[model samples]
Target: MKFRFAMVCSSNQNRSMEAHFLLKRQGFDVSSYGTGTHVKLPGPSIREPNVYDFGTPYKQMFDELRRKDPELYKRNGILPMLKRNLSVKLAPQRWQDNAGDGSFDVVFTFEEKVFDMVIEDLHNRYQVLMKTVLVINLEVKDNHEEAAVGAKLTLDLCQKIEAAESWEESIDDIIVGFEKQHRRKLMYSISFY
Candidate 1:
C-alpha cells in the first residue's frame, strides 16, 4: 500500500507545491502545507509580498497576480506556479491548522527550518495514536529550478520507499544510496502520534 505523505514549506507556494505536484501526478497519497503564519508570494518589491490567509484559494492568488502584473508574474514564474498549485489543491493550508485532520506516514520538508517547525508541531500534538511518522528534510533552495530538481529527487526517494516491504527496515540503506547518488545531505527525525 502507498504511504500517506506530506510536503511542507514556509509558504507552500514553491518548493512544497512543486513536490506536491510531482507526487500527486505519480498517484501517490500526498498533501502539502505551509508553516508560515500567512501565505506569502513574491510581489513587485522584496518588501512588498502578496500575502493571503492560509485558506485563500490558489486560483484567487493566480487571478490577483495576473490582474496586478501578468507579464512580471509570468517572467518570475509566479503565475505558472500558482496555476499548478490551483490544480493540486484548493488553497495553501497551514500545518498547525491541519493537526487534527489526519496524520501522514511520512512528512517531507524542503528546508531545515520548516522541518524543525513540523517536528515541533508534531511533538506538541502528543502521542494519542501511538503511530509513528518519519519526517525527512532535504534542503532545497526556494527557486523555480531548485524546486523542480528537488521534486524529482523526492520522487525517486518515494519510489524506493514504496518498493520496500518494510520502509523502516530499508530506510537507512535507501537513504545512504540516495545521498551518495544525489550528493546531498538529508536530515531526518522520528515523531509519533
Candidate 2:
C-alpha cells in the first residue's frame, strides 16, 4: 500500500510546490499546502511583501506580479515560481483549512515552524479516525536553488519510505538509515487524526 503524502511550507509557493511537482510527476499520492495566514511572495523591499489569500489563483498572482514589476519579479524568480505553482495546482491551499485531509500517511514540512503548525493543527482537530500520521520536518531553505535540492531530497525520502514492505513496522530503521545516509537530522512526531 502506497502512503498518501503531503508537503507543507510557510507559504507553499516554493519549497512545498517544488516537492509537489516532483512527487506528482513520479505518481505519488501527494499534495502540497501552506500554513501561513496568507500566501506571501517577495516584493520590492523587505517591508513590502506581496500577499494573497489562500484560494487566490496562481495565474492571477502571476499576472499581477508581472504587471507590478516585471523585471524585478522575474529577476527575483517570483514569476517563475508562480508559473510552476499554477502548473501544479490552481491555487494555494492552507493546511489549517484542510484539516479534514488528515488521511495522509506522511506529512513532510520544510521548516520547523510549519512542522509545529501541522502538529498543532492535528491536535486541534477531532481524532475521529485515530489514523496515525508521521509528521517529518526536513528543513529546506526557501529559494529556487534550495527548493530544487529539497525536492530531490523529498523524493529520495519518499522512495525510501515506499520501498518498505510495511512502512509502519520498519519506520525506525528506515528513518535511521535515511538520516545516516543523508547526514541530516530529521525532526519527526507521531500524531493521530
Candidate 3:
C-alpha cells in the first residue's frame, strides 16, 4: 500500500510547508500542520508577532501586513513566503485537532517540541491510533532558508523510506534507518556550513 505522510512544525508557515511542497511534488500523499496555540510569524519587532488561525487566507494576511507595515513585511521576506504559501489550501492548524483524524501513515515533526505535542495529543485524544502512526522528530530551524534545507533532508529521508518499503522492510526499521541517515546528513551539512 502507498503510505500517507504528514509534516508538522511550530507555525506550519516555513518548515512544514517546505516539506509538504517537496513531498507533494514527489507524488506523496502528504499534508502539513502546526502545533502552536496560534499561527505566528516574525513581525516588525521581536515583541510583536503576526498571528492567524487555521484556514486563514494567505493573501488576505499578506495584504493586511503590507498595508500595516510594508517595510517590515518586505524586509522579513513575509511577502514572498506568503505568495509561496498560497499554493497550500489550508492555513495553520493545531496538530492535536488535525492528528485525531488518523489519516496519516507517517508523521514527521521539525522539532522536539512539535514531536512531543503530537505524541501528547495522540495519547490524550486518539490513544487507539497512536500505535498505528510513525512519528519522527527531525531537528530543524523555523526560518525560510532553514526550511529549504530541511525540505531537502525530508525529501531524502522520504526517498530512502520508500526504497526500504519496497524492500518489504518493517516500518520501525525503515524509520530507524532513515533517522540515522538524516542525522548524518544534518551533521555533514552543519560541518560544511
Model 1 per-residue lDDT at 102: 45
Q: What TM-score, over all chains together, does every model reach? A: 0.97, 0.97, 0.84
Clashing pairs in 1: none
Q: What lDDT would each prediction earn against the true structure?
A: 0.90, 0.91, 0.73
Winner on TM-score between 2 and 3 is: 2
Model 1 quality (TM-score): 0.97
Off by over 4 Å in 1: 100-102
**For every model in order, what is the number of clashing pairs?**
0, 1, 0
Tens-digit per-residue lDDT, 80-99, candidate 3: 78777777654566676665
For 1-193, candidate 1 gives per-residue lDDT tens digits of: 5899999999747998899999999999999889999998899999999999999988888999999999999999999999999999999898899954446888999999999998998888857887889899999999999999999999999898899899888889989999999999999887887
| Model 3 error, position 87 (Å) | 1.1
Task: Give the candidates in order of lDDT, highest first.
Answer: 2, 1, 3
Among the numbered candidates, top lDDT falls to: 2
Task: State the displacement of the C-alpha of residue 143, model 1, in Å, after optimal TM-score superposition.
Answer: 0.4
Q: Please list all clashing residue pairs in model 2, or write none if there are none.
A: 127-193
